[model samples]
Target: MDEEQDPSGIAPLLMAIAQQDQQSFEQLYRLTSAKLFGICKRMLVQSSDAEDVLQEVYLTVWAKASQFDAQRGKPDTWLTTIARSKCIDRLRLGGVDRHTDLIDLDQLPEPEKIDPVEFASDKQRLDNCLSNLQNQHRTVIRTAFLDGCTYHDLAARTGVPLGTMKSWIRRGLMSLKACLEK
Candidate 1:
């Protein structure tokens, strides 16, 4: 079984969290916060907004940890679902107008137009760099960053070990960063 699915892993931590153990809560946050933050950032697209929603997500987790049941689902999935739900809620409420006076729409500045040739050049450069990677690294990097699959998800889907998947992604990202910098 994957460590994520092992009873001694996140499940035990969550069970402790359910019992109001502060240390377990801290451990859970430490273990899962980065993934949760990534999810928030992807959905919200603003660092501050994502950070605010992440805080709300953890608060919800702390309040609702007792609601988590191992039989129903894995702890990671439960946490991911909560994060998604909170992000969606934030999006839903985001449409409400807080301004007392409405500004004239005609007074707004024109949106900047991106140069398609420049955009395509960047994309082609990235594609070239990706083509230079080992096939597994390229595939894993694309799936994780482009598709937003979590490490556990990628590991389970690819039948690879979690640590290996993490290493692949880390190295792949570093290579991508180096390539992009040039």
Candidate 2:
């Protein structure tokens, strides 16, 4: 069990929130916001964007508190599911994959971002797992996926042949795929 929970999980907090209890919502945010923000920022890759999603996640939390089943999982786990689902929804809507690296971040029109749920564990298992990879492999994976950098970007940054960078990303992602599944 998460040590951070109130005596009865977040159930009491949820009821407070559902009843528009500002104080409980503040307490809940204090208790869980950091973990949730970490997940969203890692996936969304931008602080402002992650904050947008965080707001959405909280809105869902307030609206759907009754749906959370503590018997099925921890309160944190239910919160994370909502965060993750919301992130996936943004991805599905093509908001996440928008051409940022191509256009300068400042020049692009800001899109309305939903509560960002990123593909991350509620815990840091993903980081612990990723750390096991070689530094170069990690760089490739982060550049290709998280940073949304291009193969050209990788090649340019590392001074590797473009083809080589492509091959490395392909193989590296395959390794990541295997590791992620396990």
lDDT digits (tens) for residues 1-182 of candidate 1: 25535433777887787888999989889988998898788766777877988999989888888898888877777888888787767766775221122223234333233344433465577777877776777777655543345677678767778999899888988898898899
- Candidate 2, residues 1-182: lDDT per residue as tens digits? 34343333576787678788889988998888897887677667667877888999999988887776655667776887777676656655665633233322224332223332432352345565556665666666665454445677667767778898788777767776677778
Per-candidate local distance difference test: 0.72, 0.66
Enumerate residue pairs that collide in model 2: 53-115, 53-116, 83-117, 87-117
RMSD of each predicted structure:
16.5, 9.2
Which pairs of residues clash in candidate 1, taking residues 3 or more apart in a chain or in different chains?
none
**Per-structure clash totals for the candidates:** 0, 4
